[model samples]
Target chain A: NAGVTQTPKFRILKIGQSMTLQCTQDMNHNYMYWYRQDPGMGLKLIYYSVGAGITDKGEVPNGYNVSRSTTEDFPLRLELAAPSQTSVYFCASSYRAGGPDTQYFGPGTRLTVL
Target chain B: DQQVKQNSPSLSVQEGRISILNCDYTNSMFDYFLWYKKYPAEGPTFLISISSIKDKNEDGRFTVFLNKSAKHLSLHIVPSQPGDSAVYFCAATRVFDMRFGAGTRLTVKP
Candidate 1:
């Protein structure tokens, strides 16, 4: 299985611009998450979905939005980009809730907001 | 506030030596702890994990020790190899909420 896959390995966006980071998983995981890692900082959860049509905010959800329309896809949207949004974003999935042991991560997408 | 923290930013060890990475969490809600290894240009991969119930968990050359009282955990790699050089992240999770540490770069010199 491909496990988890994220699109746009690298991207640069101007201030006030918008873009979507696409994520897909072939593992049919019930839980999916979006996290961003800044330089010298740990991964901060932007959003998470326990299943399709159920999304919730996380530690750093400002300027970010997410939609889980299908079991395989969980996309993150940035309405208005800002310099503070520059970071490496990662998508991950797990077979079930509370089972991080089965978590699989995507390569990551590096975003630069200028 | 940073819930999970890896105090050491980097660590260097000679090949075949033992490399230990430490992590501490400020939240007591974290029951499951994990260690992930990340190579350059790649995503982090699961290395090992320990639950709060068990004090330790071992998998091959990797071992995880958890101290619930101190809200601390550690990963020990024995006989480290050059290929083992990478950034190690400590993660703690409760149910669906997971937090990661800043990461500690481990360099295994040959």
Candidate 2:
């Protein structure tokens, strides 16, 4: 089912530059999330969407923005890139939340902010 | 502050040996726990999971044990193979919030 897919496998950005990390899932999941993983650190939530037109901030959402225009897509935007944002980004989806449901993750995007 | 923690940064074992990875959580209300495996340059994939209601869950060569009293859980891979080498993450979730551990790299040398 293609599961989840992310675009721009790798990218480099200059300070203050902005870009969107695209994520799409064919599983028709109702919940989607964006997370960042730093070296030797666990994945930290950036933002999440419950469904189309419904979004919420996560633990580490300060420097990122997200929009859920449709059920299949949830794009994460970095408004002002900073060196601290250099890390691996992952998009995940699940049929539902707060239960036994498993979250399916994308291949991940490697971003380097210079 | 990190709610979930995997104290071991890495673990090594010989092929066909047992590999045990441990995890501890500070929140006592966590109702579900999960384990994920990740290869270099790839996102994590689900390995196994256990709910608070149960103390142990087993699937094939993998097993997960939860100790509610201690607020700790562990994953055990029996007869580990070289292909099992990867980073393992421990995760815990309550109603809407989920937290992950730093991850433990497992190397099963053949």
Measured by TM-score, the strongest candidate is 2
| Candidate 1 residue-wise lDDT, A1-114, digit = tens | 788999999999999999999999998788899999999998888999999999999899999989988999999999999999999999998887664474789999999999
TM-score per prediction, in order, is: 0.98, 0.98
Q: Write candidate 1's Cα lDDT for B10-43 as tens digits.
A: 9999999999999999998787899999998788
Lowest summed lDDT window (length 10), candidate 1 chain B: B40-49
TM-score for chain B considered on its own, for each of the candidates = 0.98, 0.98
Runs in model 1 lying further than 4 Å from the true structure? none
Evaluate all candidate structures by whole-model CA lDDT and list the values in order.
Answer: 0.92, 0.94
TM-score of 2: 0.98
Q: What share of the reference contacts survives in each candidate?
A: 0.63, 0.63
| Cα lDDT tens digits for candidate 2, A56-98 | 9889999898999999999999999999999999999999886
